[model samples]
Target: MIEILSPSEITRARATGALVGRILQTMRERTQVGTNLLEIDEWTKDMILEAGAKSCYVDYAPSFGDGPFGHWICTSVNDAVLHGMPRDQVLADGDLLTLDLAVILDGIASDAAISFVVGQERDPEDTALIETTRRALAAGIEAAGPDARLGDVSHAIGQVLSVAGYPINMDFGGHGIGTTMHQDPHVANDGRPGRGLRLRPGMLLALEPWIMVDTDELVTDPEDGWTLRSVTGARTAHIEHTIAITADGAEIMTLAPGASS
Candidate 1:
């Protein structure tokens, strides 16, 4: 369902969004070569509980995915892109890792994701992949406002990724997020502008732009039943932010406390 949150609800949404941002930032800081994926999940759980918040993903079971994610966060490593279920795998240098998180605070939910290299050994291609997602996310956010159409955001994001030569995956894109983790207004990565839903003030949208290096296809791990990996095993990157539309424009709700940008 598409929800147009009230002013008070929007206020609470900021809290949820910032919490998500801080948790992700903390995860990035603690992650390194040799760190286990399960370790990341545990840390996330401790922080969420300490904050008196609830994870939107722990009990999340949707038709497209295997029942109940059963994890605190999504740890997508290297070729893995979305719905990556954390496991016992240890990170290695130069591994591309994406941490996607969402949570409910004061009954409002917000979601975001970040992709980064694990260690000091950074491959130029990996670095480019992560940077491209960042730029695309920024472009998508810039295209959003009270007067903008959802397709404008998608077009902006697609423009950047396409120019960078990465194939966009349509299976999973952005979506409306408010009282729950996922909602209406499926925001595709690429689409025609000036079409689709017209954004309204107090609306919250989670805009994520993800791409695979050489393919648009995705394959799920049979045993894990989650982890969406590139069919070609090429490196991938994903970045997301929960945005709140205002009378003037869009404000990024997921920037961590004390973040300059």
Candidate 2:
């Protein structure tokens, strides 16, 4: 379903978005070598509860996933990219970590993700992958404006990733998000411009651009049935933010206060 937020709904959305952004930022800062994945999830739960918000993922069960997610946040590390279920493994130095979070405040949901290295031991490839995804996400947001077609946003994101030499995964991408977590007007990472759903004021979209280092293929972890890792086990990265379509342009709802770009 495509949901257009009323003025009051938009105000609540901003609040929810700020909460999600702050939670992800805090999680990223807290995640380091020796930190357990479960610890991260715990932190997320605490923060969500402190904000008096609901988790969009904890009880989320979709066809692709095994069952209810049963977790507060998605802790995807190294090869893992999307839907990563928290585990007991402790993070090591230089491990690439991606934190994806979604929450509802005042009945409006906001979603966002961030990819970063665990320690100072950053690998060039890992850093590049993360930077590429961030750039792609920015490009997609730049293309999202009132009257703009969904394809325009997809095309912009794909252009950046392709130029960076990363393959785009079509299986999962961004989508409309509002009172519920995932909604209609599927936004692919790559598509032909001037096609697909046309943007309108008050529309909310979670635009995410993720990529695996070597291939576009993905293999779900058989044990957890949630983590989506690269088939080649190569490094991966993801960047996302919840955006609201406006008359003049797109307003990024999930950015931290004073955050640049």
Candidate 3:
């Protein structure tokens, strides 16, 4: 189902967005070589409860997943790209990490994600992957606004990733988000512009651009049945933000306090 939030609902969504952003930022700051993925989940749980917000992942049973995501945040490390269930693995230096989060506050929900390297080690390939997703996300946001075609956002995002030499993965992409973490009007990473659903004011969308280094195919972890990894074992990155379409343009509601999107 597609949802267009009311003015007051959008106001509440901003608070939810801020909370999601702050959690991701906090996790990034606290993470290091020795940090465990499960620890990140714990930190997220604490913050969500403190804010009186509900986590969109925990107890989330979806067909694509094993059922009951059972975690506060998604920890996609290295080749793992999406739906990564937190576990006991300790991160190493140069590990590419992606943290995806969604939360509901004041009956409104927003979602966002960030990808970064662990410790002091940095790989040029990893940096490019991370930056490309960020750029793609920005392109998606720029293409969204009142009366804009939904495919325009998809096309813009696709152009960036495609030019960067990364194959687009169609299994999962951005989607409409409001009271729930995931909604209809599925936004593909690549599509033709001037097509698909026409965007409207008050629409909320979580635009996430993710890619694998060498392949577009994804393989689920056998043990956990959740973490989605690259078929070729290549590194991956994902960047996301919750945006609200307005009269003028898109407002990035999930940006951290005093932070730029």
Model 2: lDDT to the true structure: 0.94
lDDT of 1 by residue, 65-131 (tens): 8889999999998889999999999999889999999999999999999999988897989888889
TM-score list, all predictions? 0.98, 0.99, 0.99
In candidate 1, residue 111 scores what lDDT?
A: 95
lDDT of each: 0.93, 0.94, 0.93
Candidate 1 structure lDDT: 0.93
lDDT of 3: 0.93
Candidate 3: tens digits of C-alpha lDDT, residues 97-142: 9999999999998999999999999899998999999999999999
lDDT of 3 at 245: 94
TM-score of structure candidate 1: 0.98
Clashes of 1: 0
lDDT of 1 at 161: 95
lDDT of 2 by residue, 192-232 (tens): 99999899999999999999999999999999999999999
Error of 2 at 126 (Å): 0.8
